[model samples]
Target: MADAGYVLPDEELAQLQKLSSDFEPETTGPLVGERQSSAAITTEYANADPVYRVKTAALPSKYAYFRTCRGDGHCGWRAIAFTYLEALVREANVGKFEEEEARLMSINNLFNNVGINYELIIDFAEEMFDLLHKLAHSVSSNDGNADAILLQAFNDMGTSLSIITYIKFLASAWVQAHPADFEAFITTGDVKTYCSLSIEPSQCELDYVAVGALSAALIKPAGFAFEIMYLDRSAGEEVNATVFSQPTDQNGMLLPNPPTIRLLYRPGHYDILYKAEDFPPPVQQQPIQVALANPYNDSFIPSESSVDIMAMIPGMYSTSFGHRWPSVPYEFDASPTPQAQVTPVQPYTPTPASAAPVNTSRQDYMPVHASHQPNHSNTGRHGLHLEGPPVTLPIHSLPPPPVSIERGHLTLERGGPFRPSMYELEQINVPSFQTSIFKNSQYNTAHYMNPDFQPEAWSPDTEYGAGHKGKHKPPAQ
Candidate 1:
């Protein structure tokens, strides 16, 4: 027996055994197992892939342990994706979403210049953006709930692919925007050619050029810091590691306490690595029914701390909350089958938290109300309205478009459509092509899919008016 309550499932146990004896990408959570020492990795690789054994032998001291990701080409992107979510779970705030959203929005200029579409992946991009922000805003005492949300979102097939693919796309955009910076390193004729062959492919492991551009793009714009432990067969007694992010120019060191994401890189793969003893014990997920039984329960509520999308509703949220939605009191109607037991059948939508329509539309999905029902009486540009007395749902709750722009000739490659000799031909999780479908579709105003949506020109501070704003006439508000 493995351990009293820790018996691995038949398939999982088999995989673990295979991990020690073969070369395969880990296709699960980044921080799943306890941090394992480099010695353990070496021993595991002893009977497995000879290359891994050679690599593990060179890990530096700081990289004594690791969390390995699957080696299926996209490990680098997946590693970053996992780290971002884990950071959010750790923060548990909702408002964190809006900040991230805006940061990403600000980068539309960079991406537009790189020749990618902001339309196809926009919905997924926004959800992930909001997801992280909300987690930062949520202040749940039970962090396990936060952990569950992070894990669930990443594991969801649609989310997993959309997010990982987007990260890959972002890295590609960065490369295209700054081709001159990466020109010397690329083997292909141009950045676009290299990207078609490597970066955009879901399963292509990141190369040196991709790593630099992606590190700069993700770290600077997202405003997060990171350090990666490199365990390769290079000449080293322990795992080699390095920090990548915004550092002060004078002394050249990372700022203090900026939500660091630790990752382990062993040649072809990357994975998340948690500090052995710092964070609190991980919270476990509770059963849905038990969670819903408590009206004040917060197990299912999406973190709304940062974005405050809920707050956009007249009385839903407030900034005063430390890390959670303020609890409101409400009574539940009692039925043979308690009304609290009704489960929602719809997937969570981040657009605006919508109420299940009671009439003909989605009539099957209904929340049992004590004295009030959702008066989606009015549908506005934002979200459906929830009129009447407010109900604090802890037990249960829940949570498209096209674009424009241009494109280029994409010849085929492995794992991607355009990479030359790198990624293999495969699937397109988040298409990077710019289709000409938006013939005056009003999305052009803010979206960068059109050439007209050019970013405002920036300038250095300069002396302008003799008479400043003190004498300026106020425009109508």
Candidate 2:
């Protein structure tokens, strides 16, 4: 038996032992408890993994406290659903549930409209909503035990798991509703199987689309933002955080706060995050980049860094699927709203040799079209680097896009994008080789090259004056 090869399906294991009946086995204490200083947890990881420690240290500064969700694979579902209920509690505490009540009941229709029978998921949905209704209903019923009851319900295996199940249902319906929005991401070409196996089950770890769908469903009726702070061992000095942010204006800058709720993600787990007054407000954002193809110079060489940036580029993105339709199942709607298409400013497509910067080693500036407007974030007290020209610095030469670190978690003052996904940079139907010379270059995969050999500071104003075209300026010595 010890020598036999075996792979136990996690789903089957759950059914056999009835495991998801409680929070993850290793999960710490009760469903909801008093918030603790994040440093308590961060300090534990500090010595062993500096990356996680430094990232975790910033957590307490931003969110004075956090509420943990048992890491038993259901944390994502519990984290969002729990926060939504707590939000309702606060509303009830202040005697405000009229609107919430109507919204709660209305969401039931989404379950049915998406072709899911309510009876199948009724037990869980009912238990979850009953506690939620009580949160708002306490105003009229005057139930003083709202907090106690809510906590008990969350801790209870039956009700807690039910609500989590409903969250998964909503995610499934979301996929069913907008096949186009998430279709490409669905490999194996089977959305239903993917949802059933990956999303709509207990203990299933959520992926990007699931997070997007779940956050959208939770926030739609309430008009709130759901931000997730990613705490992984990603390649960065600090943790990478993204938001299930609301749709942005043309410039891609999100409205301030907007009643935003934060979630902390640690690899496979998620927890609730709360903000306090003591944390320092993040300083200005980093410079924003947009698509603008310089048809002027074609002799410039694309750096290897651009290749990495290219890989990060993803197709079009949206805050919520089905044109931001509030939680309802869009598939059954009589008429869906028009798509709020994201007008990507990455407007540049390279032209021939004339469109490139000179042979200045790693500095191949791309002078894009006049309409190549980069987003202007308010963080830059020093105006956008794009004030004068339609030129873009080498994607690699510049700091990371959308986010640049200066103080704490700084969003680019030039353009702070809280977007959830990024795509590769390519024009419509452009042949692969045309985009980069390296695709067919004499270079092989074995060679190692370091672009940071002489990492120089760049200033668009000083580097690219009004008439500095085709003249590639080397880094300042």
Candidate 3:
């Protein structure tokens, strides 16, 4: 007979007890979350108590960013482990990682001094060393993925657990070896006994004594500073800071702005923290200019290459040649067969005509217009006669006065394999040919059709001379 309240039957009570025992609190997020702005912390406590709101609001001003660690029992250890490798990564010094591995190996003596068996801790120790080697390789090669490697390594439960266990062993060994320092803090009055129960146990979270021991044994010797900022519902407007180590030189003087490992501690859990200056801003890569291979024709020479080659040949380009041919517009007759005819003109030939044919023949790949024949010409040296209106070749300068020398006695000397042309002899006292047939023809010195083309030069003195008179004076007045 039960009392006033109804009592459950024995089978029902057993089932309820089993259900309660089997229940576990649901946990979410990655093992170690991505680094993000610390402002999120302020937003998370926006509707919370006034003390939390004030503290979190001020957090981002000093510490620009933070990274979360899952709040399992191992968060504190995992956070410190993650941040240690991270600080090494930020340094980006391969030699330092090797030195750290060596230093850690040397501390195996500490484990031996405390009577800890090597066999028991070798698997855990190997994981830490392998990670060190991997990070060192990444930093040395400048793969630009060292941070991602570190994040992934810590996120892996097996690797993360092994690393945490290794550090735990180190903390325990350091405490036991330094009994005099930690003996007073241990309530059990035995250093080894306290470490066995508190530090070495797989289930126990990292305690204050272990943090101090790890700071002494691992971090301070490596020239890195470690800090933990406590965030809690205390009376202060901001979280409190506790520095475990400060790097110093051989003289015990503090080093200036050495790399620091900072952790944000909120009661039982820990996360990583960073100031704005922890890393340099990403650099934008400049585009590289590549020289593409010319694919149109192998025999065709580039303009620049031609200029360079011509410069090397003597007299190919000469100062004696007064003016260079200005780039003139071509307005030649397009008529293929013009019925218009004048007296049968004799063909003008150059002593260098043989080489010209070879050069022109190789340039067959060039676009050829029917009106402008680069390969061969049949009508005359000046060009063919057509019925179109006269096209004036714009003359920028006056031509040099021709000396009335004998055509037979004239001898033009040029460099290389080229010889003189008979038509190139100066045509002295020849009347100006302004006919429709000769306009824009090769006869013009400014035209590219002439091999030794030179622009005509203007003489202001001759044009405005006091003694100068026009060809047709005004009625002999």
Over the stretch 1-477, how does candidate 1's per-residue lDDT look in tens digits? Answer: 567456557668889888866765444433333233333343333333333433443231223334455555666776787776676555555555556667667776666677677786577576666666545544444444665566666656677667777777777888888888889998757789898788876557777777777677776445567777776656533356687665333365655666767788765667666542324433121221122223223221223232233334443322222112112111122122323433344321112312222111212122323222121111111112223222333222211111111111111011121113111121142242111111111112112111111111100011121322211121111
* TM-score, structure 3 vs. true: 0.55
lDDT of 3 at 36: 57
Decreasing TM-score order of the candidates? 3, 2, 1
Q: For residues 354-444, could you state the per-residue lDDT of candidate 3 as single tens digits?
A: 2222112112111222222221111122111222211221111111112211121121111111123323322342432221111122322
- Name the candidate that leads on TM-score: 3
| Model 3 stretches with alpha carbons more than 4 Å out | 1-24, 283-477
Off by over 4 Å in 2: 1-28, 92-96, 139-145, 247-256, 277-477
Among these predictions, the greatest lDDT belongs to 3
What is the model-wide C-alpha lDDT for candidate 2?
0.47
Q: Estimate each model's TM-score.
A: 0.46, 0.50, 0.55
Of models 1 and 2, which has the larger TM-score?
2
Clash number by candidate, in order: 50, 33, 5
